[model samples]
Target: MSTTPVEEFEVIIVGAGIAGCAAAKAFGTDGRKVLLLERDLSEPDRIVGELLQPGGINSLKSLGLEDCVEGIDGIPCYGYGVIRKGETVEIPYPIDPETEEQAVGKSFHHGRFIQNLRKAATHTENVTVRELTVNSLLREDDSDKVVGVSAQSKTNEYFRFYAPLTIVCDGLFSKFRKEFTTKTPDVRSNFVGFIIKDLELPLPNRGHVVLAQPSPILMYQISAHDTRVLVDVPGKLPSVSTGDLKAYLEETVGPELPESIRVKFIEALQTERLRSMPNGFLPPSANQSVGMILVGDAMNMRHPLTGGGMTVAFNDIVLLREFLSPENVPSFTDYETIAQQMNSFHWKRKNYCTAINVLAMALYRLFAANHDADLEVLQRGCFSYFQKGGDCVDGPVGLLSGLIQRPIVLIYHFFAVAFHAMYIEAKINGWSGAHLSFIMFFTVLYTACVTILPYLWSEAKY
Candidate 1:
C-alpha cells in the first residue's frame, strides 16, 4: 500500500458547533492553524441551545463572538416565570450592583446561533471550516494518543489530516469520545420541541416554566412572532405516529400553559413535527490521553431544564484560551506540557462546571416529579421561595444563571428551600403524632442526597 503525504495543522477540531467554533476562533485568533470539520456546514435548526444565559452572553463577548446573537431577532430574557397549578411567579436573573451588568439572557433560533458561530470562526484568518465527516480516529501505534483523524469529503474521497491536538467537539451524541473513555451517558428524560408562529406571551421577555402533570414544560420567545415550547416527558416518549402523542400533549401539557400559549400549543400539534432529544448527564472528567481532549457536550452534559449548557461550554473555551494563550504555551503540540496544562484546566473549571451541571439535573428531578408527595411540596416550595423577592430569590437565580460558582452557596440555598417546604407542610397538616415531622425530615433528607451529594462527588473527584 502506498502512503499519501499527511496534511498537518496546529489543531484539528471535529464538529463545528458552538464548542468547535469557539475553539477554532480562539486558536485562530492566536495565529494557530485550525481545521474545523463538520458533517453539515449549513445552519442547524435543532431544538437545543436556543437560549443563552447572561453568563454565556458575557463569555461570548469576551471571546469576540458577541455578534453571533445580533440581527437574529433574538428576544432578551430577563428571568424565569414559574407557573404551578394556576399561580405564576417571576424570578428575574440577579443584578450585581457592583458591576452593574444586565441580568438578561438571549433567545433565538438554534440554527441562527450556529450560523453566527461559523461566521465568527471563519472570520479569523487561521481557521478553515470545511464540510467533512470524520470517519475514524488516527492514532500513533497502540499508545491510544490520537494524532489526527481520517475523514471523508463531500465527494466521498478519503483524506488524512494530522495535527498535534485533536479536539472532539462533536457534541451530545459524540462518536469519538467513547474510543478513549468508556462512560455511557446516564439518560434521564426526553424533551420534545416545537414552534408556534405569531404567538404572543404575557411575560414578554422572560422564559416561562410550566410545572404540570407528566413533567415540566418550558416556553419562551425565540423571535417577535414565534414562541418555542419544550415538553419534558419523564421517559422515552411514544412515537408521534402512534396517533396518541398529540392527545397526550393536549391532556397533560396543554392545560398547564396559559391561554395565550395554549392556543399556540394546539397550532403546533397540527404540524405533528415535534423534535425530540434525550436528556443526558455526564460528569466532567479529565482525558488522560496526551494529544486529545473533549469539549462541549462531547465532554460533559447536564439536564437542559435550566438551559446552562451554552454557559458552561463558553466558559470552558474562555478558560482554555487563558491557559493556552500564545504567551503561555505558543506551541500546542507539546505532549508533556499540554497534558500538564489540561490537568490544571480540569481543576480550575470545577467551580462553574460543578455548580451548573449539578443544578440542572437537580432542578429537573424536582420540577419533573409526578406523584411524590414530598416532591410535590418541594415543587410548590420552590415556586413560593422564588416569590419572596429578595436574597431568597437572588441566591438560587444566581446559581441557575451560572453567575454564582460556589457549590457551598448552592448547598445552603437548596437546604433552605427544603426546610421551607417542611414549614409549608407543617402549616397545612399540623405536626401531630410526629408523623408529619418524620415526612419532613425524610423529604429534606432526600433532597439533600440527590442535589448536594452528587455535586460534592463531582467537585471532589475532578
Candidate 2:
C-alpha cells in the first residue's frame, strides 16, 4: 500500500489575516517552522481594517514589519476632527514626552495593507503560506488536545498537516471559535460604507467623525484620491435591493453631513455600490484548550468605531512572541508550561486590550445616541470636553489611539467628562431651584455608571 506522508511543522497557523501573518513571521523569525493557511491569498477588499492607530504602528515596527505600510499610498493620520451640527473640534495625538516627536498612524486600502502583510510573512525565514481551506482541527481520540488540521487545496486534494501547536486566527466569522469558548459575538449595530472621490476634507490628514442624526459617520482618506465614509446605522437596516437604503442615505444621512462632504457624499451615493458590516462586541477569553489557542478577531472583537482592531491585534502578537519565545517555553510539547504562559498572556494583555475594548464599545454607544436622553447629553459633553483642550482632549485621544494603556487613566477621564457634562447642564439651566439641580446631578452620574460599568465587567470575566 502506498501512503502519502503528512507534512509536519513546529506550528500550524490557520487564517493568514493580520494576526495570523504576524504570528507566523514572529515565530519563523525565532527559528520555528510555521505553516500559514488561508482560503484565499488574493488581496482582501474590506470596509474595516483600513485604519491603523499609532500604537499599532509602534507594535508593527517592533515586529520588524514597518515597511508593510509603505508604497501603498497609505495616508498619515495625525489626529481626528469631530463635527456636531456643523461645529468642529480638532483633537491631535499627544506628543511623545521622551522622543519629542508626534505619533503617526496610517490609513490605506484594506486589501493593499493586507497584501503587504502577507508578502512580509512569505519572505520571512521559516514561514510557508499556502492557499488551503482548513476543514477541521485534528484532535487526539482520548483527549481534547488539538494536534493539527485537515485541509483541502484548490484542486480539492485532501492533505493532513501536523504541528505541536496550532493557532486559530480565522477572523470575525470564525468557524472554530466554539471549540475553545462558549462566548459569542453581540451584534449592536451596522456600518454602511461609501467611497467618495476627490472630496476636500475640513481637516487634512486627520480622521473625521461627524455626529449625524441616528448615529455617527466616519470619513478619512484611504488613498490620495479616494475617501472612505462609514455611516453607523443602528439596529435593523433598510433593504438594499428595494432602494430603501438609498432613500435613508439621501433623506436622512446626506443632509446631516458637513457642507464640504455632503456634495461628494451624494455623488458617491449615486455611483458607488454600498457595503455594510455588523458592529460586534466579544470579550477576550483565556486559552484553556491544550495544544491550540485562538487569536485576533476569532478570540475577541470590538466595535470598529475607534479603529482599534489592528492596534489590539499587533500588540497581542508582540506579547505572544515574548511569552512563547524559545527561552521562555523552549518547545510546544510541554503543554503544562504552555498553558501557564497562555494564562499569563491573557491578563498581561489587558493593559492594552482593556482600554481599547472598553473605550470602543462605550464611545460607540454615546456617539450613536439615537435620541436617548442620557447618551445625547453625554455626547455633547464629550464634544465640549474636547473643546476645552489640554488633558481633556489629550487623555481621551491617547486612550483611543492605544498609546496610553492604563485603565485607570481611561476611568479618570471618563468620569471627568461626566462631571464636566453636569457642569455644562448647570451652567445652561442655572442653580435657581435647588431641588431640581440635585435631581439632575445624580441622573447624569447614574447614566455614566450604567454606560461604562457593564463593559468593564465584561472585560473582567474570563
Q: Pick the candidate with the highest lDDT.
A: 2
Where does candidate 2 stray beyond 4 Å?
1-4
After superposing candidate 1, which stretches have Cα over 4 Å from the reference? 1-5, 99-101, 432-437
Candidate-wise lDDT, in order? 0.85, 0.92
316-336: candidate 2 lDDT, tens digit per residue: 999999999999989989999
Compared with the true structure, model 1 gives a TM-score of 0.96
Which whole-number lDDT from 0 to 100 does residue 373 have in model 1?
67
Model 1 score (lDDT): 0.85
| Highest TM-score against the true fold, candidate | 2
Colliding pairs, model 2: none
| Model 1 clashing residue pairs (backbone) | none
- Please give me the total number of clashing residue pairs in predicted model 2: 0
Model 2 residue 371 CA deviation (Å) reads 0.8
